[model samples]
Target: MDYLLAILIIVYVALMILVGYIAWKHTSNSEDYLVAGRQSNSYIMALSYGATFISTAAIVGFGGLAGTNGLGILWLVFLNIAVGIFIAFVIFGKPTRKMGQYLNALTFPEFLSKRFNSKFIQYFSGLLIFLTMPIYAASVLIGAARFVETTINIDFNLAILILAIIIGFYVIFGGIKGVMYTDALQGTIMFLGMLILLISIYSMLGGVTHAHELLSSMAPLFPESAKVTGATGWTTFPTTGSPFWWNLVSSIILGVGIGAIAQPQLAVRFMTVKSNKELNRAVLVGGIFIFVTTFTAYVVGALSNVYFYQTTGQIAIQAAGGNVDKIIPTFINSAMPKWFTYIFLLTLLSAAMSTISTQFHVQGSSIAHDVYCAIKNRSSLRITRIGILIAIIIAVVLAYILPGNIVATGTSIFFGICAVAFLPVYLCALFWKRTTKLGAIAGIVSGTVSSLFCLLFTYKKVAAGLGICKFLTGKAVLFSGMPWPYVDPMVIALPIAFIFTIGVSLLTKNSKEEEIAIEKMFKAEEGA
Candidate 1:
């Protein structure tokens, strides 16, 4: 059985390699490589964006998180549809695509600098993308590798290296078009796999009502060993201050929910589609994809806890003993038929790699288009390829060195940073004329720095409070509470970024040239 699954995995990898090779033929010029010649249709954009957006985080990480949290995790799907697809495209899509067309911006940093006419904004934004995106890429590695390790009982590090090489090869060779095309294929596999898993698990449990009742009655009524904590059985909502509730509302739901709009990898999807009309088309497809994908995964994950607790009398705990990242992988490997587990594992890898490929591509573009271009004083394709190579190398090293649980912790940090760092400046550039170069710079710096500060300080506070924080200051003694004071870093970072953009814009008037540039790009009426 295990051999069958392993063989299926090998086949999936080969198919992906073939896809990458096919995409290779499309990449003669930098424009083709970077933005797909600005010609991706809405169908590709929808599936590709959904694939990149949904990753191991959605399936493994969020699934595990949802297992413990109950149906409350469905809130994220609401946001993905409402904020990520609907509001994002309606509000930000037209302008973002318009700007991308007007300025011929390939990357998010390029969009910022070109709009505001600030070389500094471009350089710093590029630097942030290069520096910060690796954490996200590493998280994808950890999440996908965890699925492999848990499913097949392979060594985690070996799985990480294997998965990294497979994903990195396609991305390094295939670039943007390869990534998006594979992302669409990956999206289909993930959607179908999760859906099938959901049906199978439900059938095994004897139906929805039976499963719900079983899950509900298991926790408190069961033995002490089975006494539900985290995601043992999501029969009911958390008993106040439960890690389940806080994590669902704050970390999973709020963090990824709002974080979607400003994501560099996802943002560039708008540029791929040709017009505002194409973007509108993406909304329906993208919304349905996100809803079904997230709903199936969350339902299966939360209910899998029901299956596990019923069978084993305890939640499937991570051997390293952390949160629920290990839950869905364990559920699949242990509960499902071996053949299905193998099929699902490929789907899981596809989910992670599709997103990982996009992150590397975006990071590469940020370096190639924004930072290296500014530094070298020319947009050289050779320089871009060099930047892409450097980005890949960094990702490879970080994927190897980054500690395991960093996926949940590290990914949150990256999303929070992008939200704080880019969203405000983007809003300002699109809407406000008074946004001077200095104001744009200040907003970005403030948001990026403050977001990092909040994360660092909060992590320290939590570690110290847990009595585990060590090295250097050793957990600020004053933080007596268990988690210290870690809120979503976005809460702090986002406000500071906004203030800098709006406050500074109000204080510092834009030059006539800057104003003219903004108006011409926006094609706005005087009041608008």
Candidate 2:
């Protein structure tokens, strides 16, 4: 079994390397490296987009949450399909693509900086991304590394190092083209692997109806701490207005759902394709892809409770030693066929690599292409490669040290920060002509500061454990005023940022050149 699994992994990795080599040979310029020369097809773009967005966070982090919280996680699935894929593509994709071409924008920070003609916007945004994105990237690394360690029975730190180096090799050499090519292949694996796992879980439990029925009947086993947080059961939504509900609705769902709009990696994909039409076509495929992968993972995660209860006389969380993040991996190891366990490990690897590669690429672009290049007034491909390596090293170290359940914590931090810091400015830059450079700067500063403050003073995770917060406050959280232990900054910072942007913009005036650029952006044709 070990030999067979090793063979499968070697073959899969070899394919990835071959694809990277091909992409490296074709990467003759920065454009090809950054945006795949803006010539990707709808299929490749769609799969790549979905794969990058739905990483181990979806499969492992949120899947574990479903094991504890129940079917209510489906609300996130609905939001992903509706807002993430459909609205993102139809409402934001076209204008972004057209304007990206109009302004010669390559990265998200570059797009904003060029849009409003603000060097501060460009530099600050790039610096923020470079600084904060490692948390999210590290989370993805931790998720995949956890599975790799458990499945291969190796030292956890060594597993993380191995995974990071492999990912960095391809991303540093292949650029965006290699990343997307691998993403397409990885996305297919994730979709198929998830489908099979879901089917097998249901078959083991009789069927979907029986499986859910059994799960629903186990509500009495719900945890007491979960009860205080408003958890009704694994089969129902937490009590509205309860701490759990707030954590679920405010932190997880709203943080991630609305946050998707501002994700630097995903947003960059809009500039990768040739036309808005390609983005439009991608919506359908992406929607289906997200649904299949996320839905199956959530459903199977919750149902795994029944399987564990029947087999081990314990629930999913208990069987996995009380770590929610370990629930899915444990189930795969103990409950599934040996052959399928190897397959699912690849799927998890696919999820991790697809997402991490994008993170590394975007981080590299943030520092090298956007910050350094803009300041130096030249694009050095070598600098970007070096940036990629630096980003990988930082993320790998963080992955080794991050707390348990790093997936959820890391994902929430980055998503919440992006929603608060970037979404308002990005949205206004794309749609609101009156959005001045000052307004954008004000929004960015207020958003980032407000979110970080709230995270340090209000959220328990960062407030209590983050040494800086504890040193300054002498407590986990400075203020105990929050109704819940966990409330994402988006609930507060996002609104503040949005209102501040509008108010500041209304009070300020755009320069003549800025006005002309905004007008040109609004009226520009594709490839103009």
Candidate 3:
């Protein structure tokens, strides 16, 4: 790591702090803090949305995932654009914006609680967000710091703390305006860095034709373990019933695709826009952003393996650090020019920071605005700042103690949990006419408990790694289980929650209060 390069990176961090300082002026209330006063234009909205959604999980996890999974991982980029961005803006964005406006709800929990009529739903959902988001945030911290420490040679713990403090305080002070403004800027860095990396790699490998030909000839670059796992070659395409295929099709694509529609962090962007037309405008920009950035990232992640194989005849299996997580950084250090590697480090740091800030922000307000404020009737910036502080502390602790693939696993668990606990009650609040409060409560409990139980007792890595699952389930249930498969727990739990909600609702007659709530939703929606 050159001194000049390290200085350059540190300067960028300072500039980000300055941006957050600027955002402090814009936020005066809960609305401003949470959703930028609901006035972000399409460009800001789209870029910010894209940056936040493309977290360290996408770069660190997905890039390494590509090394092992091969071209098959390309499926994720398509899903991100189509389901994560495009349809998210079209289908989910519109309704979320309309209802958020009608209910004056700033957080997802607030939206669901206001839409339905349950305090338990609001507080419990907030608890879930607060609990899981830190694990995700810690993962983001770990990813950003790992790259910085390796590329620049900073201590691991020091880098993690510095990054966390900067992001935490910036978000705590600047709120949504700061988050979006910086995200848009970071999105540009990510795009340009990837562009440079791809062009350089292909050019170095003797152009596209030579590179592809060399890569294709080495079909055995992929190990036999991949085939048993149900994958073709990483350089080639996917095969049938492979874990890779099931993971791509069933878990990654379908799980995240359907799940993105319900993501609170992204959904808030719809509320931030000034009008439906702005959201409509955002789809084009968002589509282009996703296409370019994600396209470049997936391309780089997949093809880096090709580059490695052709150059060293050694597979991507931890030649440098012995961990898959280091694959991209190792590639940058070895394959890319020093200047570009520096920029790529910034690119990754920015991506990780952008998403971590949002996660922390969302987690804080879920506690402050949705759970605490709804009960306590407090919404001061000071109270929100305290909430942010508490959330950051928890996340920071997690960052130090244990973190690997934390963001990815946390995402699977978080999204799965949200899908189960929030999805059924949320949709009912918006569209269903006959949903009862009893049903909503039943759904929340069943979904949350079921998902936790599955993640604990059934997911082998999660259970064995934590050891608490072993204690609760004892040896038999722990050792005998098939382990949570490719499908996130949401796959099973969501349906059960919906069933529990609907079955109970159908059995019970709607109270006049429930009728009035439905009528109000329709009336407000029609007028809007």
Q: Please report the candidate that would top TM-score against the real structure.
A: 2
User: What's the lDDT for all of these models?
Assistant: 0.77, 0.88, 0.76
Tens digits of per-residue lDDT for model 2, 94-129: 788888888888899999888888888889999999
- lDDT score of model 1? 0.77
Q: TM-score of predicted model 3?
A: 0.93
Q: What does candidate 3's lDDT look like per residue over 306-337, in tens digits?
A: 76766786766645455666777777888887
Clashing pairs in 2: 70-234, 229-244, 463-476, 464-476
Residue-level lDDT of model 1, residues 478-522, one tens digit each, is: 343543353566876788899988888778877888777776766
- Candidate 2: TM-score? 0.98
- Per lDDT, the best of the predicted structures is 2
